[model samples]
Structures are given as structure tokens and as C-alpha cells.
Target chain A: MAAANENITADAIEATEFMELSRKYRVTGVPKTIVNETIEIMGGLPEKMFVRQALEMPEE
Target chain B: MGLLSPQDEATLKNHLSGITIPVQLVLFTQAFGGSESGDVAKQILNEVASLNDKITVVEKNFVLDTEDKAKYKIDKAPAIVILSDGTDTRMRMYGAPTGYEFVGLVEAIIVAGTAVIDLDPETMKWLQAVDKPTHIQVFSTPT
Candidate 1:
């Protein structure tokens, strides 16, 4: 997504290695996703679902 | 000792062979009071960089390179900032790229080197329509 749009930045962080960031974001599970610090998605979802949630678009 | 098996290295090299443009991996690591994963991350990046002539690894001191750290807006140690032909791809990976994380790193590199995003048509439309600044952080553990 970051590559698709220049306005977007994506970061993949290892929970165990970056404990401070994990704690700050309250990440207790693996594959937890935080979008703009406003949206918290737990676990992995399908491509469409993940993209929709990341973009804050209403379900279609 | 090398981390990747011989077969895996061959496969990874094959995957990286199609890159047309240069891909730069800027790594930030703290030499002192940092986790051992910094070394692991460096090794992983070095291994990947060794596969493709177009790929290069640039190391930086997380503590001493304050200017570069701030320029990249990196607040964490053992971070990877991916660049495509000297341009920021806005993709970052923290901690060692192992397990599934390794796959993600390779995919990101491909995107950077090719400037091609392999998203679904509808997803591409949505992503391209994003006018506002979006910051995405994905948290996972090596398993």
C-alpha cells in the first residue's frame, strides 16, 4: 500500500524484538495491525478486508 | 555460519534476479545496549544483498547517526528503511527479517526495485485514491 501511494508509509515490526513499541501499541497478539494509530486490527484477514480497514472504508 | 540453507539461498536469489533498478537497504543498529537481533538483521540483509548485484546494504549507527535517524524518522534500533534507486519507498522493517518476516522483506524489495505493486485491481484503485497521509504498522513475532 505504501508503494501504491506516496502518502502512505508502512512499517513491519517484530513484536518480540521491539518490546517497547509492542507495549506502546498494546500488541498482545501476532499479526496485529495498527493503521494511523486509530485502527487496530487483530490477526490477518483477506486482502480486501485488510485494505478496506487500513483505508477506513465502510464495508461494501 | 550462514543462516539460510543452500537451497533457500538459491531460491531467494532466483526471486531477486528480475530487479531492474537498484534497491538500497538502509539499516539502523545500535552497537551498545541493543538486542542481539541487530546482528541477526545485519546478517539477513547482507545475505539478501549478496544475491543481487542491484541490491546494496547501507549500515548506520542508531546512536551516533542522529541526523540520519531523524531524517528517516526512526526512533527504534535495528530498523530497516528500504529505498528504490535513491528514493524512499516508505517501507520499514524492524527487527531481524526471519521466518515470514523474511518473505515480507523480499516482497518489499521487489516492489521497490520494480515500482510495481501487485495488488488486486480494486485494491489498487482504493490505494491509489488515498489522498491523505496513512501510516501503517504491522506487528508480528518470528515463529
Candidate 2:
């Protein structure tokens, strides 16, 4: 997503290395995606689903 | 004493062979008061860069290089900024790129180097339509 759009900035953070950040985002599991600090995705979803959630787009 | 095994290096080199443009991995690390992961990250980056001529690893001090830190918006140590032909890709990896993170790093490099995004067409449409500043942070363990 970040690659396709200039407006998006994506960070892949090592949860174990950054304990404070993991705790702040309440990331107990792996692959926890937080978009804009508002949208929280607990686990990996399908590509389309993940994109929709990240963008806060309505499901079709 | 490279991090990647012989077989892995061969496989990775084959994968990186398709890259047509330069990919600069700008790494930020604080030598003092930093965790051992900084060294690990450097090793991994160098190992990966060794396989591809177009890929280069550029080191930066997190504390001393304040201008670059600010330019890249790096707030932590052991951060990697991916650049495609001197342009910021806005793709960052924090902490050591090991295990699953390693796969992601390679994918990001491929995207940056090839200018090819493998996302679905519909997904690409949505991504291209985004007009606001979207900050996405994905938290994951190395294992």
C-alpha cells in the first residue's frame, strides 16, 4: 500500500524489540496492524480486507 | 560468517536479480545506549546487499545525524529507510529484520527496486486513491 501511494507511510516494527510501542498499541499477538492509531487489526487478513480496513473503506 | 546460509544466498540472489533500479537501504543506529539488534540489523542488511549490485546499505547515526533522522522521521534506533533511486519509498522497518520481518524486507526491496507492486488491481485502486497522510504501523515479533 505504501509503495503504491505516496500519501501512505508504512512501518514494520519488531514487536519484541520495541516493547513500549507494542504495549502502547496493546499488541499481544504477531502481525498486529495499527492504522492511523485508530484502526486496529489483530491478525493478518486477506489483502483486500486488510487494505479496506487500513483505508477505513466501506465493504462492498 | 554471513547470516544467510549458502542456499539462502543463492535463492535470494535469484529473487533480487530482477531489480532494474538502485535500492538504497538507509539504516539508522545509535552506537551507544543501543541494543545488540543494531549490529544484527547491519549484518543482515550487508548480507542481503552483497547478493545484488543494485542494492546498497548506507549507515547513519541516529543521534549524530539529526538532519537525516528528522528527514526520515526516525524516532527509534535500528530503523531502516528504503529508498528507490534516491527517492523515499515511505517504507520503514524498525528493529532487526529477521525471521518473518526478513521476508517483508525482501518484498519491500523488490517493490522499491522494480517499481512493481503485486497487490490486487482493486487494492491498487484504493491505495492510489488515498489522498491523506496515512501512517501504518505493523507490529510483529521476529519469530
Candidate 3:
């Protein structure tokens, strides 16, 4: 997504390596994504579904 | 010892053969008071760079390079900033790129090297339509 738009910046962080951040974000499981520091995705979903949820778009 | 096997190197080299433009991986690592992952990250990046001529690794001191740290808005040690043809891709990796993290790094590199995002058209549209600044942080374990 970051490549698609200049306004988007994506960071892939290792949960184990950044324990403080992981705890701060309440990452209890692997593959947890936090967008804008609010929206939380628990697990990996389909590509479209993941993108929609990450962007906070309404489901169609 | 190198991390990649001979077959892996050949395959990775072939995969990276499509890269026509230069991709620079700017790595920030603290010399002191840093985790051992910094060394791991450096070694991994060097291994990847060795496979492709168009790829280069640029090292930065996380403590000393204050300007660069601020420029990339890096708040932690062992951060990787990917640049495509001297332009910021806004894609970053934190911690050592090992296990599954290495796969993510390779994919990011392909995106940077090819300038192509292999997303669904609809997804691409949505992503391109993003006007506001969006910061996405994905947290995952090595396994």
C-alpha cells in the first residue's frame, strides 16, 4: 500500500524484537496489524478484506 | 557463513534479474546499547545485496545519524528504509529480517525494484485513493 501512495507508510515490525511496542499495542498474537494506532486486526484475512479493514472502509 | 544456500542464491538472483533500477536499502543500527539483531539484520541485508547488482546497502548509525533518523522518522534501532531509485518507498522493516520476515523483505524489495504492486485492481484503486497520511504498522512474530 505504501508503494501505491506516497501518503501511505508501512512498517513491518517483529513482535518479539519490539516487546514494548507489542505490549503497548496489545499484540497478543502474531500477525496483528495496527493502523493509525487505533484499528486492530487480529489475524490475517483475505487481501481485499484486510485492505478494507485496514483502511476502515465499509464492507460491500 | 552465508545464510543462503547456493541454490537459494541462484534463485534469488534470477528473481532479482528483472530489476532495472537501483534499490538502496538504508539500514540504521546502533553501535552500542543495541540488540544483536542489528548484526543479524546487517548480515541478512549483505547476503541479499550480494545476489543482485542493482541492490546496495547503506549503513547508518542509529545514535550518531540524528538527521537521518529524523528524516526517516525512525524511533528504534535496527530499522530498514527502502528507497527505489533514490526515492523513498515509505516501506520499512524493524528488527532482523529472518524467517518469515525475510519473505516480507524480499517482497518489499521486488516492489521497490520493479515499481509494480501486484495487488488487486480494486485494492489498488482504494490504496491510490488514500489522500490522507496513513501509517500502517504490522506486528508479527518470526514463526
The fraction of correct interface contacts reproduced by each prediction comes to: 0.93, 0.99, 0.93
lDDT of 2 at B20: 99
| CA lDDT, candidate 1, residue B47 | 90
Q: How much is B37 displaced in model 1, in angstroms?
A: 0.6
Q: Ranking under TM-score, best-scoring first?
A: 2, 3, 1
DockQ of each: 0.92, 0.96, 0.94
Proportion of true inter-chain contacts also present in candidate 2: 0.99
Query: In candidate 3, what are the lDDT values of residues A1-60, reduced to their tens digit?
Result: 899999999999999999999999999998999999999998889999999999999989
| Candidate 1 local lDDT, B55-95, one digit each (tens) | 99999999999999999999998999999999999999999
lDDT per model vs. reference: 0.94, 0.96, 0.95
How many steric clashes does model 1 contain?
A: 0
**Model 2 — interface RMS deviation?**
0.5
Against the true structure, candidate 2 reaches a TM-score of 0.99
Whole-model alpha-carbon lDDT for candidate 1: 0.94
Interface RMSD for all numbered candidates = 0.6, 0.5, 0.5
lDDT of 2 by residue, B1-143 (tens): 98999999999999999999999999999989999999999999999999999999999999999999999999998999999999999999999999999999999999999999998998899999999999999998888
Q: Quick one: best lDDT, which candidate?
A: 2
Candidate 2 positional error at A22, Å = 0.7
| Model 2 stretches astray by more than 4 angstroms | none
